[model samples]
Target: MAALGQHAVSKVKNAESQLVQEWIAALEASGGTRNVKGDELKADTREFLQLITSSLENGAGTAIGAAQWEDTRQFLERLSRNRAQMGQDSSQTANFIFALKGPFFALLQKEFASEPQLLAEQLLQASELFDALGLHTIRTYQASREAVIRRQQEELLELSTPVVKLWDGVLALPMIGTLDSQRTQVVMESLLQRIVDTGSEIAIIDITGVPTVDTLVAQHLLKTVTAIRLMGADCIISGVRPQIAQTIVHLGLDLQGVVTKANLADALALAMRRLGVTFTKAQ
Candidate 1:
C-alpha cells in the first residue's frame, strides 16, 4: 500500500476542527453517541485526529501494523475496549473510525481538485488506512467482550457455591443448578477450603435446590465426599427426596460408603451426634 500523500496530511491538519465536528455529527446521527458523554467524545475525537495526522506525517502508510503506527494502534485498542465495556457493539465502535471518511474525502477532493489522478490516489490510500483501523477496532472490541464474559462467569461460579458454618465443627454447602465438571471443581475447592479454614470435622451437602440427581451429579457428590475425607472431615449427603432416591435406585448407582439423609434437618442432627454436641429443649 502507498503512503498517504503530504497534501492529505496537510489538509487534515489544517481542517482538523471541521473534520472532528463533521465526524462527531455523523456519529451522533448514527446513534453512536447514546452511551458516551459529549466531553469525552470530543476529547477522544481530538486525540484520534491528532494521532492520525502525526502518523501520516511520520510516513505511517496504509499498513497500520507498521512500527510507526504503534501509538495509533494502541489508542484505537483502548478506545475499542472502552466502548465494549460501555455496552457498545462492534458496528458502533467501528463507526467511530469510519465516520471520519466523509469529512476527509471532501477535504481531499477540494485540496486536489485541479489534479484528479493525485486526488484519487490520496483518497484510495486514506480509505485503506481507515478501513484497516476500523477492522482493528472490531477485533479488539470482540476480545474485550470475551474477557468481560469470562470474568462474569467466574464471579457467577463463585456466587453459586456458598459454604455456611452450620455449627461448631460443622459446615454446610447448599448446591443448586446442574452439576458439571467445572461447577464440581468449584464446589470441591470451596468446601475443602472452608473445612481447612474452620477446622470443621463434618460437612453437610444439601441439594434441596438441585433439580435432579443424575450419574454426573452423583459422581460430583462422590468427588466432594472424597475430598472432605482427604482433609480429615466427614461429609453427609442430604436432601434425598423420595424421587431422587427412586432415581438412584433405578439407575443402580451405589452410594454405599457415603452417609445420606432424607432432609437437611436430619443431616444436621446426625452431624451433631457424630460430633458429640448435645442440646436441650426449652420448657
Candidate 2:
C-alpha cells in the first residue's frame, strides 16, 4: 500500500497541536477517556501524534510490523498495557487510536481539497494505518489482561494454602479446596519452605475443608508428603473423614508409612507430643 503522501504528512505535522486537541475532544466525546487522567491523556495524545508524523516521514508504511514503525509499535504496546492495568476494556483502548481518525481525516480533506485522487489515496492509506494500530492495541490489551489474571491466580494459590507454625517445631497447612496438581505444587513449596525456615520437625497436612478425594487427589497428597520427608520433616495426613477413608479404601490407595489423623486437633496433639512441647493449665 502507498505511504501517506508528503502533503498529508506535512499537514499533520504543521497542525499537530490542533490535531491533538481535536483528537482528545473526540475521545472524551466517545467516552474513551472515562477513567484516564486529563493530563496523562493529553501527554499521550501529543506523543502519539509526534510518533505518527515521524514514522511516516521516515518512510514507514501502513504495515505497522515494519522496522521503520518499531517505535510506534512499542509505544502502542506500552499504552495498551497501561490501559489494561487501569482496568480499561479493549474497545476503550482501541478507541484511544481510532478516535484520532476525526481530526486526521479533517486535516486530509482541507489539505487535498483541490486534488480528488490524492485525497482518496491519502485517506485510504491513513485509514488502513489507523486500523492496523487499533488492532495492535486490542491484541496487546488482551495479552496484558491475561498476564494480570495469571499473576493473580498464582497469588491466590499462595493465599489459599497458608503454612502456619502451630508450635515451635510443627507447621500446619490447612487446605480448603479441590486438590489439583498446581495447588499441590504450591502446597509442597510452601510447606517445605516453612519447615526449612522454622526448622520444624513435623508438618501437618489438614484436609478438613477439602470437599472430596479421588485417585488424582490422593496422588497429589502423596507427592506433597514425599517432598516434606525429603526435607527431613515428618508429614502427618489429617482430616480423614469417614467418606474420605472409604474413598481411599475403594481406590486401593496406600498410606503404609504415612501417619494419619482423624482431625486437625488430633494431628496437632500428636505433633506437640513428638516435638515435646508441653502445656499446663494456669493454677
Candidate 3:
C-alpha cells in the first residue's frame, strides 16, 4: 500500500513538472510577460495547485496549506463576483461569470500569485461597465427624442398669441417676449389665417414688447412676409429698435423689399394707403 501511494505521487509530480515547464515556455512566447518576479510567482502557484490536486487524489487530510489555500479560494470567489458585477448598471449583465481560458488562468497565476485578483477583475469589469453604459445612453437618447418632440408640440400649443384687430382692413399682433423660429412660425401661421379670415390686406406686426431679435427672428420675418405676399396681403413690421436694426445690418440681413415702419400707427397708415382704404375724421 505504501509503495503504491509513493508511485502514484511520483507519477503525478512528474506529469505536473512537464506541465509547469510547458506553461513557462508558453508564457515566455507570449509578450507582456513579467521577467524574474513573474517566474517566481508562477512557481509558487504551480506548487500550490499541484499540492491541492495530489491531496485530493491521495485521500490525504489536505494538500494545501491552511492559510494560503483559504486566502486563494476567497480571492478567486471575489474576483469572479467582481468581474461579473462590472457593468452592473445593465440589467442584462447581472450574474455573469468569466469563462477564463486556460492560458488566461496561467497568466493570472504568473502575474498575480501573491495578491488577490482585484486589479485584474476591476479592469475587466470597467471595460464591460462602459459597454453597459453606452447601451444605457443609447436607450436614454431614444427615449429623449420622443420626449423632445412631445415638448416641441407642447411649445407650439403654448405659442398661441393674442391678435387684436384694430380696424376693418388693418390688424395688429403685438409680439411680446422673445421669438424663436418655431414660435415665429406659429405667429406667422396665426397671422396668415387671421388675414384670410378677416380679408385684412394690411397687417401690423408690432414688436415694441419684443425683448430682442437675432438672425433666426429676422429669417422668420422674411418667411412671414413672403407668406403674406403670397396671400395677396402686405405686412408692415413696426417698432424697430435701434439695437435690432443695427444687429440686422451687422448680420448683413437684407430686408430690401420688406416694408418696415417707425411705429404701429405708421404701419397701420401704410397698410391703409396700400389697401386704398381711409378712415375719415368726424366733421
Clashing pairs in 2: none
Candidate 3 residues lying further than 4 Å off, grouped into runs, are 1-160, 279-283
TM-score of 2: 0.93
Q: Residue 142's C-alpha lDDT in candidate 3? A: 44
Residue 280 accuracy (lDDT) in model 2: 98
Return the TM-score for each candidate structure. 0.96, 0.93, 0.44
lDDT of 3 by residue, 1-283 (tens): 1111343335445556655555555545543123235665375447544643454345442222344344434433342333233322222221111111243345434444566654355335323533433343334434444565688777755555667798887888888877777777778888988999999878888888777777777777788888889999878899998888788889998985888876888887777777788789999
Off by over 4 Å in 1: none
State the C-alpha lDDT per candidate: 0.92, 0.91, 0.59
* lDDT tens digits by residue: candidate 1, 137-246: 99999999999999999999999999999998999999988889999999999889889999999999998888999998898889889988988899999998899999
Ranking by TM-score: 1, 2, 3
RMSD of each: 1.4, 1.7, 18.8
Cα error, candidate 3, residue 97 (Å): 36
Q: Which candidate is the best by TM-score?
A: 1
Clashes of each: 0, 0, 0
- 1-283 per-residue lDDT for model 2 (tens digits): 6799887788889999999999999999999998899999999999999999999999899999999889899999999999999899889999999999998999999989999999999989999999999999999999999999999998899889999988888889999989899889878887888899999999999998899999899889998888888888899999999999998999999975789999999999998888787789999
